[model samples]
Target: MVAVVTALVLLVFIASFRFYARFLGRRIFADEEPGFVTPAHELEDGRDFVPTKRPVLFGHHFTSIAGAAPIIGPCVAAYWGWLPALVWVVLGTVFMGAVHDYGALVVSVREKGRSIADVAAKVVSGRVRLMFLCFIMVLSWLVLAVFAMAIAGLFMAVPTSVLPVNIAIVVALVIGWLLYVKKLPPLLPSLVALVVLYVFVWVGTKVPLDLADTGLDKDQVNLTWILALFAYSAVASLLPVWLLLQPRDYVNSHQLVVGLGLLFLGIFVAHPSFDAPAVRMSGDDAPSMFPFLFVTIACGAISGFHGLVASGTTSKQLDKLEDARMIGYGSMLGEGALALASTMAAVAGIGLVGFCALPGQGPVEDLSWAVYYDNWAHASGNKAAAFVLGGGAFLQQLGISAVLAQTLMAVLVISFASTTLDTATRIERFIIAEIGDALKVKALQNPYVATMIAVLPAIVLATMRVADGDGGVREAAWALWPVFGASNQMIASLTLLVLALYFWQRRRPVLPLVIPMVFVMGVTMFSLVLHLLAFWAEENWLLLGLTVVLSSLILWMSAESLGLFVRLLRERRAAREA
Candidate 1:
């Protein structure tokens, strides 16, 4: 019965998203007109703007946006109970995330494939454009920093994932060469690559690699992986889209689909019941769910980061305007599905391990549910570990050995996260170059120079250590995640504001976009204010300053947008009177 409920819920969410997609296509986007030339064709250079087929583009977009966030956020947020997390993931994706992504894609498509920041310049003002650009650069920096640390942590914790991850990169390069250099058909080559990658996953299980076994201290091992990741990002950022970014994501997308299928099948066979509480408060230490929940589960529900991917990279590669609906909105639903799976795993798998109590909360017998989640939340650097253990437990039901199942789960996460890391570096490079153009700085305009500038700060932040409550030091990435979530959600609010302005200018209805914009703005600002108070109390000056900057920028943009809305309304009324 429990398994049946889970399956039904997932199916219903998917079916509803499909219907919403159709509605959006007809009423909002108004369908792609014939003879419309996409930027992929008009600006095709066999590089960033190369025309891509639907499946390949969807794969790239989905994998790029579907990083560890969806998995990690839901895993951690399950502390409030899986029921609330599941609700947010389902509704947020259908209404908020998909709308933001699809709108950004269509608006960018119409604007010659410019980013939402660029569109803000035309629709709002040049000053707004600059502010948005700055906001995005900071957001991207955090993304790169956090994801790099995440992949490094995963590799260190699950060493078997290391070999498969590196091997997948080699496979991607080979696949890139075959598809682009040799002019082979992509379908057959991508399929063959997928098969070979899975074979490698099996090989990885047989011989897991551990960095700690080499006699290095924990910090030293982490530093080694961090440096290795940044070095790879530098090279990957400079490579053409056809070479590394697109092909690698395409392969990772296949792995994600296969992994999800097995997880769901395992759930059915295992019939894992809900183990966590339906709704439980974490006392005064934890923030209430109101704004925190919305921001914590950003990617699964709605994320501003997807707007950057949609406009910054994906729009440039869209072969057809019509495809944006699927690539934009459909990909979000795919991520939501992943989040749901993670939530289910966290709730079910945590119980099997016999440590289900909320952190600092004593165990309670005779509770309705079998597991406690707050305990997992308090386990530093173990959020990802929890998800892996939970997911592995599910896979175990499929007759896989516990060791092999955990390794497979680790490979799935590391591959997804690594795809996000390099892609973010590339996106950050683009933003840096655009900032150069905005500021008229020649040196910064060079992609290589801009990439190095972006990478340096990320590397430093990723490697830097800060003192934790236990008097032990932890990587700065752990400290920055809360701020990252707030900043990320702010970006979503700003993107929605941009979309609202775009729709208003065309005399279209803006209610569909405006409601989510206002709601996200309110929730994110509330959360940021709370974070600001907390950071001040702790004397974390670095994060405190960042919070101030982001808050100020968001407020400034909001004021400017209000002014624009008023002006646009007056002009429309005047034109009607005339």
Candidate 2:
């Protein structure tokens, strides 16, 4: 009954959002302009600007944006309750995330496919552009660092996932060759490739490969996997989109759809009741639900990163103006659906395997809802492990073996993270090049040099250490996650501001853009302040400095944009009177 109700609610929200997106596209963006030249057509290059079919472009955009964050965030945020997470996922996607993504795409298309930061230069000021670019660079660094570590962790934690993940890459290369070089039809070949991927999944379960078994210590294993993943990113980032990026994402997109379908189906068949509390409040030390929930569940509901992908890549490949609504707005709703599934799994499935004690916390005699939430809130890695276990439980409901189900779930997570890491690297490469051009540095314009510049910081950060709860140390990824959430939502707010400015310049009603902008700004800023205080108390100077810098940039950019928007509005009024 719970599963049926959840499914119905999600379906209704998704259907309604689709219709609303159409209305916004038609009325707000006027996206139906006939024969408007798209950047793909105007600047068709074999590399990045090639005109793409709607399905292919949507796959690329969705997979790139719908990475491990959506799954990871909601899984952790379910600590507050499934109800809150679900509500935010649905409403945020419909009202905030979709609008941010759609508007960014429209603005970028109008600006010949430049990034939102680039668009900021013309709409806001040159200083705003520089700040926005710096903001994006930092955001990308966090994304790359977090996701690369995530994939490495998954590979180590679920060793059976390694072979399948590697095999999928090889299969993507084959599919890319068929689709681009041989001009083979995509559907049949993609279907075959998916089948091959699953075959590897089954084989991997039979022969799991653990890196620690190869005579390396824990630290050495972590370092090795991190280095291996970034190496893969470097090469993958440099390759042509048709060769690896597009086809690989296309494959992963299918995997996501299939995974979601199975999850929902298993829920319906198993009829798992919600065991976690509908809402839980921890002690005074815990973060409150107001702004923290919004920031904590950042990507599941709304992500500023979606705006980057929309403007950075998707706009350039749009086949038609109308497709912007489908690709941009639609992908966000798709991500919301993923977030919804993750929340359901965490609340319901995790109950099947009673909650365990968090790191540095001794084993409990019995696990309760309060203990579960408390443990997860304290140990980020525990939340990730809990999600994997919960997702595996969902798969087991379909009569799959427990080991196989867990491996499959890990594979799904790794695949999502890998795609995001490589795509972000490529996007960062472009950003680095753009920054170089802004600074008038000729050497940094080369893609290879730019890509190296983009990846090095992430490598350095991922390998950095923070004190582990067990009196040891762990990679900085988990420690950096809170900052990532604040930064991510801040990016979304800045994007909304840019879109609002776009509407204002064109004399369109700015209410749609402005409302979400104000709400997100409030939520993100509040959370940032809380994080700043927390980091200060803990004497974590690095994250403390990051929080301060990000807060300052957001304030600076917002002030400049607001002043310019008012002047623009007044000038427009004066011109109309004349």
Candidate 3:
């Protein structure tokens, strides 16, 4: 609809403003003191620190932030009432998401590209850093496990999916080898590999998965696969970037950009109306609106996880101080755009003439209607009517079936889930190594040993839970949402604290620090409480126990922070301490 066109334009404008404010407006600071060149600035090399073009960084950042969360959250949250989900996504991204992401990257760059945990150590103490690291490790484990199962589930769903993914991985490996080992031109090989991968996807659908009389339990087998997958992830991450990480990201980034463009084009041409009811129909089974909704949709609006990506991977690569704004702010806006695309997809099925009004459920419930009980835009007449309304304009122009277009949309959702699994696994392995090294356990420090130690628990938990008929790993995935949200927020809180530290040392304005710091802390703690309660209610005593342990660590650190803040404030009052 033209209505959606206006929304898209507005988002682009807001995103552009955020990018400019972050980078180009570096001269227009609220206040400034001495020019402080942090380690990242001092250690700049063109390899990592080369100034990235905004468009290139846009692709990089967008692919980094864009993942299953945006897709899955929108699809599920749409069941709530698209309006709330829509509002939260659009408004929340502009204010909270962009601010959190952009600020984190900028702050990390200022601190010489130290990770959030490292920053916390400097701002707080070595003990706090250790605690933060441990918290992150545990959370990373959950993220890896959840995504592992998710990717496997996607593979199982399509039956033929294995072929496409396998081919893509192989193509990536070939490209990696040629580029790194043989010193081949990266761009050409990457392009050729991607084309090969796409052809394989089409061919893959032709091959059968032998589903008939298959004896394996999908859930049980999936859990086992997740464990085995982590073992591989451990090995992969421990190796140099030329081996796996950089190559995959490079190929995946191109794929992501191309795929996203195609999907957007399909949507533009299809002109699907919002068919689902704007309101979500609720039942007694639904959890309390407050906690459930907040947890269900963590990454789309604002994720603490974004802080980790910003501070850990991206910050270290900043070529210039100004690049922080473009890479940070602009990337987040891309994520918001993806969220908006999902929201619009959900809304597309609404309000079609001659569409026999059926009760709309699933993703459409949230945006178009206020209450769950209202009339919804059903898919039947909705698609047909849009086709008629467009008078063959869009279809004739795009030359794509609306239904095939929808399938492509779904594929993108699954791809995000798959890519996230790979990324999450790599990160978790690093966390495991860090924890193991800290504990000074030789066996634990061994990559294989640590990976097995980390993966087994999740596999058993996923399997046993599934065997017990609780939807297995799928249900356990729910338990993970809050923990992921909190851990990410905790990272954000730490990042902001670093910014505050830099300002404090430089004798600059402290109000900016106070605002974000307070809000993130509140949201983080609230999320932690909700997660703990959910674990206890589910009678997941093991996780419940782990939650208690982690909470104790986080609370102790938080209390320590408060004490430090108070002492600092008092010290400032006593003497204008910079």
Give the higher-lDDT candidate: 2 or 3: 2
Task: Score candidate 3 by TM-score against the native.
Answer: 0.78
* Residue-level lDDT tens digits of model 1 in 266-335: 8899887778778867555667878788888888889999999999889999999989988998898888
- Pairs that clash in candidate 2: none
Number of the candidate with higher TM-score, 2 or 3: 2
lDDT of 3 by residue, 1-578 (tens): 53465356456548555564544234322212346454444765533333333443444456656776675566456556667667677655665676677777766676676667767777878788778778876766666666666556555544555566655556766766787579786678778877876666556667735333267775555655565566656555555534554566566667766765654665666666555556665555554445455445567777766777776556655555666666766666667766666655444532322222222333342333222223222321121122222221222336654333323333455556555555555455545665666667677666566656666665554444422125344345435555666666666665566556655655666555556667766767777787777777777776677778877887877887777878887987889655
Please write out the lDDT profile of model 2 over residues 298-321, one tens digit for every residue: 888889999888888788888888
Distance from true position, residue 373, model 3, in Å? 10
Runs off by more than 4 Å, candidate 2: 354-371, 376-379, 467-474, 572-578
TM-score of each: 0.95, 0.95, 0.78
Q: Model 2 reaches what TM-score against the true structure?
A: 0.95
**Which window of ten consecutive residues has the lowest lDDT sum in model 1?**
366-375
**Worst 10-residue lDDT window, candidate 3:** 380-389
